[model samples]
Target chain A: MRVPILSLGEVLVASIQDALTDRGWRQLQADLLAQAGRRPPPGSRRKTAPRGVVIDLSTMDVMDSYATRSLDGIARMLALRGAETVVVGIQPGVAFAMAQLGLGLASAGTAVDLEAGLALLAEQVRGDGRHHGA
Target chain B: MAVTMAPESRLPVRDDGEIVGARRAARALAATLGFSETDLTMIATAVSEIARNMVEYGGGGEMTFAVIDGDGRVPGRRGLRITATDHGPGIPDVERAMQDGYTTGRGLGLGLPGARRLMDEFRVESAVGVGTTVSMTKWVV
Candidate 1:
């Protein structure tokens, strides 16, 4: 399915606890990738793929190597969907640790203020103006 | 009031379940001192990574969780102690293991150093064949 690039409205998030399970997230990512390849229903108003994902990692304070890599994995999966992910509300220490582990904001995608992230998603939907084939 | 600590809890590193158990224990200890949800998640993620490292690299081992009250010297802090030990071949070089993206397998070598970043204190002791013990503590004041 060719991921649409203009239909994004509200962000979608998979189950956090579920994704954290052993290789469970990997499977989800795969499913998302497959879904990304499809087009919206006939006569849909939106034009682009859904604005990727907004991981509400606000509940996180401590992170280990696995979580860092898992995040990267999630980011990579989203990219396959032709949508970018924006991580918001991350604490300084957590952000620092992620950078130390090489999971920096830039490596995965744009790390922006919450407002900016929403705006970027809206902008992507508005600017594309073309319905990408599914 | 004198309180006793939980004796080490150990489980084979067979799956993420083991990691969850260890993180739950760590979170419970953190809760006793009023840790925020963000803090709890951080500790959980860190512990989960270490536990995964034990299973993947160490060929499986066990994890331990304990609690500690930071000494006055540290000022305004209490802690939850988590230790994951493995009998499998110990890390050849602790320093190298701490580096990011340093992995021998399809893994990101963020386990050790990532945990250190999440906690207020981190210590590691390992010997080739002897074993490895990683002790970490997250503070909650």
Candidate 2:
């Protein structure tokens, strides 16, 4: 199934609700990249470029090495498109397991929850004035 | 440890969907054994890693789960044992395979070592051109 991606002004949000299959992950990557390249509908007031992307994993209870690689790949791909990636809502248990497994997403920003994630994105946008003011 | 409950289930690991199914099955069993949310998540993650490895590198395999009762010294100790087996080309070097950042596939190379860390006990046996089997266990405190 396609994980929905919601656009909030200059930031894109995707809440992963379930364990994704390999195909689902591949599709999500393609969809996110495609959405990032989309232009504001002719004469729309919103900004044409996305400044940041927030991936909420609150509902997800488990992540394996493959999933970790997928997240890292997505972050790298978004960086190439000039968008910062923030992964939020990692549970304490999941964090422990990830650390034990030596899985780390070094390139992406991480936060405790959705609010912090959005705030982090906003801070990034404000810090780099080029992507501010939708 | 004596086998208090020999309850066992086998799941086919052929694709990504099957891998998720295997994780769910393992989680359900672990949950019933009074595993904490953290423990459940750890077991599920380990299951996923091994199941995926079976499908990816082992050319499809099977996952078997069983419950074991601890001895008198460790009273009330219960653990879930998960075994994954595949009849495919086996790992040439188990030592290198267990090392971090050593992957033959397009992955982060954390599957074997990561799964081992998440579980209390881990054992693997493989022979070139024969097959591979990985067994892991998580105990309840």
Candidate 3:
């Protein structure tokens, strides 16, 4: 199934609510890149360029090597396309598991929650001198 | 030396979807054994890694889960054992494969070693032209 990707001004938010297959993850990567390339929604005067992408994984209880690797790849791919990526809402159990597995998402910004993720993204955009529509 | 095997269930690992299924099943079994939330996640993660390896590198395999009850020394102790086996080309170098950051696939090379770290007991047996089998166990404290 496709994970929902929501656009908030200059950022794209994807909340992964389930453990995704490799195909599902590839779809998400494609969708995120495609969404990043699209123009800002109508009625918003923000720049057409996407400044950041936030991936929320609060509901994900398991993140194996494959998922971790895919996230890392997606973050790097988005970066190459001029969009910063933030992974947020990693559950404590998942964190412990990842740490034990020696898996790390080093390429993406991370936050403890959605609000913090959005704030981090906004801060990044502002620091880069980009305009995030109100 | 001699351990009695409890009832077990086998799951096929054919694709990424099956990997997720295996993880869910493992988590459910672990929950029945009263594993904590953290332990549940850890066990599930280890299951995912081994199952994914089976599907990816091993060309598909079967995963079995069983409950092992302690005997004389440690009475009333219970643990879950997961075994994954594949009749595909096995690892040529088990030593290198167990090292962190060694991967033949498009992964981060954490599957084998990482799964080993998550479980309390880990064992691997593989032959180059034959197949590979990984067994891991997590106990309830």
Candidate 4:
């Protein structure tokens, strides 16, 4: 199973929204859709469903509730298409804050730092393929 | 410099499902106070939850935010103070309202309790037929 490496940098939800209006978010969704329709990477394993998505959240300067909820919506949308998502680099403090805010991503899948997240994804892909396999 | 504080600006809850606006307000306020991103998110989430509660259960209310400095004044670290007040029918039992997974409607009932959990200081006051006021403070430092 070939996995893509997603490196998340500092993302400030406040800054992102300020930089892009609602149109920007719409554009992002459109871009993702267009990209997903493209051909798979060379020598990629063919499975019942496409491999999952990896998100790097380590560089997030500030993540507000609105962004968290929006991200949640995005994750759920991707899940419907049988794509697993791995969110890495979420600060422990931020994770706690998200939990307190009721984001509940912890239950959705595995969350870890960059190294751990990748290792976990690799293990999941090697082990049961059914963890997120649709 | 005499800092002016008004709680009325933050009042007038709206449950139009405008989560963006709620978070926007929180980020803006936290930034002005030099709060961290984590703290900013927490404040915005609390505001969103409480505001939703006002619209859902209390039939809407007014919210107010105040700037609090920690020169050994109030308790905890320095931070901004947010208060939501509503004249709608108050909660019959405050304790039940604070409990997690407790809701009178389709909601997850994570409003009040969830908001309280995000902030360092939280207080709720309510009376039958009168209304309810929820005050929360998040440390900036």
Candidate 5:
């Protein structure tokens, strides 16, 4: 399925609602990267390129190594484009499975949900020396 | 008394979709046996990894989910058994394949090792150019 990347103010949110095929994941990466790189033209509601990306995985019951690594790559690439990524809504069961499998998103910041994701983004850009350097 | 009505399912893991089907089947079957939600997710995730590898490396394969009793060694112990078999270019170095971060340059190389860690028992039998079979089981806790 084509995972939609919704722009929430300065944050782009993609809620994974189903099993993403290999192509689906690749497509999401491309779309998110493209969107993350693009800035709203002048005269838009607020300015600056998107500051953060939120990927929701509540509906994803299975996060195999493939998915975990893909998400990590997305976070790193987005950082390169000056956008931070926050993964949110990982199910408890899925989290346990990931821990057992020794799979993890090493670089991406994680939040409990979308609201917290946005909050984390805001905090990172707050210029308070707590942004984790990106 | 043992539940003799142990059910089993075989799913053809050909494409990405079938890999999903296999995961669902595993979770559903495990649920019927009263596996906890965490266990269900673990089984499903392990199935996903092995099934994806079957398609990505083995060019397609089959997955079998069965509620099996322990074989002689631990009789009456019932749990879920997952076996994935593929007839493709088998691994030349099975040992290396089971190591974390040992990939053929496509993925993070954690599929096999991660799957193994999720399950209680895991065994991989492969012959270069012959075929590969992975059998893993998670006992009820």
Candidate 6:
């Protein structure tokens, strides 16, 4: 499934709502990175690119090692584009599996879910959670 | 030592699609055996890794699922047992391959070791140019 990238002012959101196949995940990575730091598409009123990215994985039930490493890589690449990436909504079961597997999102900011993830990104940018919503 | 009493269900795993199928089959089978939610996730995840390894490096293979039962003989050893066999080039050093962070492909090298950690019983048999077979059992507590 091709995930739609939504914008929340300066933050971009990619909510994965389906069970991902390999081809599906590769496409998602490409789509997110392609828009990470690029300027707003032509004919838009926004003057700035996304300052942060929120990847919501609440709907994801299973997260294997390959997907874990891919997300870690995406986080680092997003940093290179000047966008801080927060991975949120990791399912309890998936989190347990990842821990047992020794997989981690070492370089990215992690939170319980979308709300917490955005707050984390906000704090990183201005040291205040309220700043991003302003 | 546990005894498996049910007939085994076998599936041919040739690609990513089959990998998904194999794991889903695992979940369904485990649920029927009354495995807890957490255990179901663990079993499915382990099945995925081993199935992926079969496709990525082992040149595709066959996966089998068997339901183990105590039958009043083994007590709480009832659970799900899985075995994956592949015809692709096998591992040269099974010990090193079983270590965490060891990989011969583009993966994180967590396939074998990570799957091993999730299951209760795990073993691997391989010959460099011959093939590889992995067997794992996740017993319900």
DockQ of each: 0.34, 0.80, 0.83, 0.22, 0.77, 0.74
| Candidate 1 TM-score versus the reference | 0.73
lDDT of 6 by residue, A67-121 (tens): 7887888888888887888999998888999899988899788899899999888
The best candidate by TM-score is 2
Segments of candidate 2 deviating more than 4 angstroms: A130-134, B71-75
lDDT of 5 by residue, B1-141 (tens): 444436668889999878888898898899987788898899999999999899889999998888886554666777899999999999999999999889885877878998998998999999989899999998888
Residues A1-134 of candidate 1 have per-residue lDDT tens digits of 11112324545443243324556556656655555555667788755456566554554555556665666777777776776666655666566656655565443534345566566656655565565552
Backbone Cα, N, C clashes tallied per candidate? 15, 0, 0, 10, 0, 0
- Looking at candidate 4 chain B, the ten consecutive residues that score lowest on lDDT are B1-10
**Best-matching candidate per lDDT:** 3
TM, every model: 0.73, 0.95, 0.94, 0.62, 0.91, 0.91
Q: Of the candidates numbered 2 and 4, which has the greater DockQ value?
A: 2
Of the pair 1 and 4, which is ahead by TM-score?
1
**Candidate 2 lDDT by residue in tens digits, B77-98:** 8899999999989999999999
Cα lDDT tens digits for candidate 4, B48-112: 77876777788877777777655365453456788888888899999999998788864667788
What proportion of the true contacts does each candidate reproduce?
0.47, 0.87, 0.89, 0.32, 0.87, 0.72
Best by DockQ: 3
Docking class of 6: medium
Candidate 6 lDDT, B1-141, residue by residue in tens = 456479999999998888889999999899998887788889989999999999999989999999888735567568788999998899999999999879989888999999999999999999988899999998778
lDDT of 2 by residue, A1-134 (tens): 89999999988999999988888889989999988767788787895688789999998888887888899899999988989999999998888888888889998999999999999999887787865554
RMSD for each of the candidates: 5.4, 2.3, 2.8, 7.3, 2.5, 3.1
| Cα lDDT over the full model 2 | 0.90
lDDT of 3 by residue, A2-104 (tens): 9999988889999998989999999999999998877766877985778799999999999998899899999999998989999999999999999898888
